[model samples]
Target: MDIREYRESDWNQVWTIIEKVFRAGETYAFSPEISELEARNVWIEMPKKTYVAIADDDEILGTYYIKPNQPDLGSHVCNCGYIVSESARGKGVASRLCKHSQQVAVELGFRAMQYNLVVSTNEGAIRLWIKLGFEVVGILPNAYKSKSAGYVDALVMYKELKT
Candidate 1:
């Protein structure tokens, strides 16, 4: 998959993936009832930049957003969220997006990257993030009310992008 900065026309495809993930209450904490306008503002307008992982034919396989972890004094650290289309999960789409995000983050002048609410029960993601060099910096007990797993902890994963 090729990862690149998002385009205006990519919104529908990006929303399709995000809406399904959010509504499932599996990973993201966004309300299932979030409106299109709200989603546009959050996933598109709010971040420093957004990206899409596309296939050879240009079908969007996954998406991610990067932004400052905090405002003002804390803005040197960046944050990101990723979502891969279900059909594209095992194909390394997330891996590509994540690696690409770091490069973009550094290019954008961010010194580190953080993921504030990674659901603990999601072993695959946790493993991948660890493999990608993110450490479990903190854990919020019973943080995410996963639909299937009930109340699960959320992990704060972080990685330094530069020495």
Candidate 2:
């Protein structure tokens, strides 16, 4: 697996991954009915940097975006979101993207990284993140009206990067 900055030409495969993941109503907070343009804006427009994980043949396996947790006074801390292709789950793609994102964030001068809205019911992701050294700093009660879990809380995780 390899990780790299996103390019315009990557959107075709990127969108396919996004569509598959978000439509499943499992991990991300995005609405299942989210349109392609809206999805583009959310995944591309909002982040300071976006990255894709690809296989040896260049098949996109997962993606993530990093941006300031808050602009102006809070730019030192960054926020990130990730999505893995359905077929690529459980294969460490998301973990690789996450580890890479932290490295890139440090190289970009970010002091810390945070995940703002991780669904509490997503045990696999929560476990992976914790194993990756992110701490659950807070929980937003009933933040995600999950399709299966229903009104689940969102875990706010934070990790301080080495300067």
Best by TM-score: 1
lDDT of 2 by residue, 87-146 (tens): 899999988999999999999899999889999889999999999999999999999988
Residue 92 miss distance in model 2 (angstroms) = 1.4
Stretches of candidate 1 above 4 Å error?
none
lDDT of each: 0.92, 0.92
Counting clashing residue pairs in each candidate, in order, gives 0, 0
Per-model TM-score on C-alpha atoms: 0.97, 0.96
Residues 1-163, candidate 1: write the lDDT tens digits: 6888999999999999998988888898888778888988999999999999999999999999999999999999999989999889988888889999999999999999999999998899999999999999999999999988899999999999973
Model 2 — which ten-residue stretch has the worst lDDT? 20-29
Angstrom error at residue 26, model 1: 1.1
